[model samples]
Target: EGEWKVMLFTCSYSVGGVHGHLVDYMQPEAVSTLLGMTYGEYDKRYKSYFGDVIRKTFFDDVGFVHMEQTWTPAITEIFREKYGRNPALYYPALFYDIGPETGAARIAFYDIRSELMAEGYVRQVSEWSEARRMRSMGHPPENYSPNSVVAHGDILKYYRHVDIPLLDAILCFRRGLNGFKQVCSAADLGDKPVVGAELCGAYPEEMDSAMLYRTTLEAMARGVNFVVSHGMWYDTDPQTVRIPPLIAPENPLLGPALKGYSTSTGRSCMLLQGGRRIADIAVLWPINAIQAESYMFRDAESGLPIANWHPNDVVNYALSGMLTNDLHRDFTYIHPENLTDGKVSVEGDRLRLNNAENLQEYSVLVIPGGGYISAGALARIGEFYDNGGKVIALASLPS
Candidate 1:
């Protein structure tokens, strides 16, 4: 029998508190409660509402076991319990909306509805996916790309746990080459060993094989491995569907164009996967700074980060987007928490990642500006500098 890989496309758990959103919230007072707090206060405690709540209820020492009755014993196994099922390759096709006012509204809705479980789901899903991937002979689980142009920093943050970073680069139409470059570069630097995650959104309406070939090569150059076309629809009547020609047979490009795309990108994936990267530059993610900026804007139209948004403030967002472009050498994110937690340490004038199997070393740490920072992280940076590690602060010191 042939193997089948299933793709589950859904809103990322990070968008709202995990127990599902309380979209039909009853209380107007709840919105007032959410708006009452300053962004800083919200930033520190947003997880308390969502992530922490789920961690206590769903996960335990043995890992994520499906204990909730609502999820189990259901006809479809909606909670994704893998028991009694054949081992099959599975990957998440994730998406979410953007903008500042939009993000603020999501947080407001969660606060009003008392559904604080959304923020922490991404990490939880990452853990669950890792466990499932281990159970699968060798199939890997790709990560969900963060929503919006500014929120892209979250994609880099995802690298800490996942091997693949899947981005829906075409959805925005605003996201073009610059966007894809930033995304692929981040994934290449992350834990992704050899093969990067699938890059979706190559539509025939957008471009044919020639454009596809060039795009695939560009991604490969930036370190993307596997490729999945934007999508294929079910065999319903062509008139019924809005977007067609997506490998739907009737689409004129399906015959040779699809075949050529599959052939070219598939071969490139084999050549790129399983390779190690070497880098001397460490990009320090301005975690607090990004959070600080995200609070300043509220985008109700799209939804808040469910937890928080990106470094929307001009300085940090622009800096982060272009930070890796001309670095000339490979670079990886230096999580501030990791620095404080000792996951990153100084060794003989070089900063080293302590947790990886092979160990990654970096000589320079570039900190993007504009966020509230922890004293512990500041001390760690001081330690790095004292140990002869180089530092590049974009505009202002973290404070």
Candidate 2:
């Protein structure tokens, strides 16, 4: 029973802030209010709001031990009260210390896996189906590919030195194994198919380039099944230095539908059609990109990183999606050194795409986000557009 090889998602989640976003939000009045309530009163209100099963999931099964202390329980209670059961997302929160059990082949988190390693925990990560990636290249690919029990060097390092239960008021080390554990906790309970996480330092520049490549390969060795990019940006948020969403209502017809579609199945179908990508293999392929930094027009210091780790941007992804959607090519690539590697070649104003190995057969060629571009690159782009090629640009504007 594995339904898919990998499951793609955003990683800024946790149970009550246990994983990526666990910050305590306790207040005196919050608990005082909870204690003041009577069980009879609470039960009546609970069912009156949230239907039956959810009422059981929270108050019965879990006892909601500290529902008031954790924001989710309280928030979940509200959702159940009004909407009956919470959306599908409510139960499978990674923070629950209980991973998703939808049974659609399982995927696990690299951040959580790393913590297990540090704490002398082990698992057969390969059994899971989803791709496993870490935020940054913490180690080398050759190191973990076969899923050995060597326990990463950092694990040994921390075992010998570093302290546990330390708090990093700031993101002390976005990629340092210590850094990940400070915020996240394991939820898979030792069951998963393919393993992957939002690997790579928050920004590609955090660790030098060479180190980045090694870390990715290492994730493979550690039994990480795939690497969905940390993210692509919607826009930029300078205060947070995060790659924010490029979230503008960019002509619903031209970009993502401003509104979601009706029916979950219908919504999924529409999302696939709107130039967005829905990958199948769920494998790991690292591309270099700032997680998310959007500075439509700003200076470097003032520049914001679109928050999600989008090593490959929309234009290229859209293009890739077009190829995947339209063509049926069994793929193979000569390991691109970078997103804009020699795949699309340009020599003295002559724009040519060599290594058409997989792409040569496709009718449309879409190249989206790459790093900074030069006048020469624009010229080559113009040439490609002129050659009767269908191209879609996400953040890349015309010359």
lDDT (0 to 1) per candidate: 0.44, 0.27
Least accurate 10 contiguous residues by lDDT in model 2: 57-66
lDDT of 1 by residue, 1-399 (tens): 799754553322212443334221112243234333432254356544533433211111110111111111121232134234321221110013334333333322222111112113334334543433321011111122222222222444433443445444343222343334444544544545443323335344644556556656655655567665544566536575455335444565544677656776778788777646566777775545543333222322336432224444324344434644544345566666777777778786788876454357888887766545667878888888998889887766644
Candidate 2: stretches off by over 4 Å: 1-342, 346-353, 356-362, 367-372, 395-399
Q: Considering every candidate listed, which one attains the maximal lDDT?
A: 1
| Model 2 per-residue lDDT tens digits across residues 83-138 | 56543453343223233332111111212222333332111111110122111112
TM-score computed on alpha carbons, candidate 2: 0.21
Model 1, runs deviating above 4 Å? 1-163, 172-190, 194-206, 240-245, 248-250, 300-317, 320-329, 355-358
TM-score of every model versus the real structure: 0.57, 0.21
